[model samples]
Target: MRIRFKLDGQDVEVDVKHTDTLLKVLKDRIGVGSVHFGCGEGSCGACMVLINGRLRYSCLTLAGYVDGKEVTTVAALARDGELTEIQRAFLENDAAQCGYCTPGMILTAKVLLEKNPSPSDEELFDALAGNLCRCTGYIPIINAIKSVSRR
Candidate 1:
């Protein structure tokens, strides 16, 4: 089946199988390597992406389900070789260790900040609850979100 969607900031069309997950289509066919496949189940949140401005686990989302939607990955957060504020905060706070979960974390935080602008600590925790980072111990990650939210 042929699927069409807005990826990053460009309109993209590709042929995909019905069973193909968004993570596979993004990485394999579209050459988007940032969306990693950690657990293949939705539990890890490593494959998170924004579809029509909502966060969704790409590992469990079928390619066909996203047809005609807008898909944004971590790659979209950086523009003109400059990182977004959340990315900068993550770096300043040292939120990443292994770096496998940074993309999903940043994207999830992006959605949160966009909606709330100034979220409380609990709201930040709730926003990032779905994402898991085996490294960094989560304090720095929470601090990073707080830093960005305070700005």
Candidate 2:
């Protein structure tokens, strides 16, 4: 099937098979390198992306699902080679280890901060619960998110 959607504010039109996962379409066909493929079972948030402003795991999402939606990734978080505040925080706090999960973590934190600029510890932790990071012990990751937090 032929589909068109907005990716990182850019129009993307590609032909995809119904059996193709969005993750494959993005990373393979579309050449988006940031959205990693970890657990194909949706247990890991490594393939997470914002579909129409809401988070969705690309690995579990069919390519047809995002036919007309807007998809946002960590790549979109930066503009003109300048990192977003969250990205800066992640770097400043040394949050990334292997960097495999940084994209998803940053995306999650971005959404959380967007919804609740001043999220409490519980809220912050809860938002990050879905995204798993095997490295960094999560301390620096949490601190990175909190660094740019308004509350």
Candidate 3:
């Protein structure tokens, strides 16, 4: 089957099998290496992506489910070779460590910031609760979200 969707601001059409998870199609067929597969069961949130502006675990989502939808990965958060404010904040606040979960975390934060802009600490935590970072312990990650929210 052929699936068509918008990826990182570009329209993309790729071949997919019925059982293909979004993560599989992305990393294998689409060559999007940033969508890591930590826990394919979706509990780890490592394969998170924005489908039509909603954060979803790509590992749990089928490629066929996203046809004609807008898919945004961590790679899409940059513009003209410049990082988005969320990305910059993550870097400045040392939110990423080991860099394994950074992509999903950043993309999740991006959706949260876009929707709330000035989310409270509780709201921020709730938004990022799904993304687990075993390396950073989430202190710096929460701070990074706060930093971007202020801007």
Candidate 4:
């Protein structure tokens, strides 16, 4: 089926199979590098994307499910060679290691901050519970998210 959605602020149309996961479509067909393929079972947040402003696991979301929705990735958070505030905070705090989970973590953090600019540490932990970062632990990531809200 042919699906149409706004990807990273641009309109996109693609043909996908019923079994095609959103992760495959974004990485393979659309060539979106930020959405990583992790567990492929939605257990890991590596494939998280914002569909109509809500976080969803791209690995579990069928391509056709977002036929007319808005999909936002980390690539959209930056503009004209400048990083978004959250991105800058991540960089300042060294929130990434191995970089496998950075995109999802950043996206999740963005949503968390958006919904509650002053999330408690426990809330921050809960927001990032789905994302697993074997390296760098999560201190830097937590600091990055907290920094954004502080400013």
**Candidate 4 TM-score over all chains jointly:** 0.95
Reference-based TM-score, model 2: 0.95
Candidate 4 lDDT, 98-124, residue by residue in tens: 999999999998899889999988888
* lDDT, candidates in the order shown: 0.90, 0.92, 0.88, 0.93
Question: Candidate 3's residue-wise lDDT over 64-112, tens digit each?
Answer: 9999999988887788899988899988999888898999999888888
Comparison by TM-score, 2 against 3, better one = 2
Per-model TM against the reference: 0.93, 0.95, 0.93, 0.95
Instruction: List all candidate RMSDs to the true structure.
Output: 1.4, 1.1, 1.5, 1.2
lDDT, residue 67, candidate 3: 97
Candidate 1 ranges beyond 4 A from true positions:
none
Error of 1 at 68 (Å): 1.3
lDDT of 2: 0.92
Model 4: residues with Cα > 4 Å off, grouped in runs: none
lDDT of 3 at 143: 88
Q: Can you give the lDDT of residue 80 in candidate 4?
A: 93
How close to the true structure is residue 142 of candidate 2, measured as C-alpha lDDT?
92
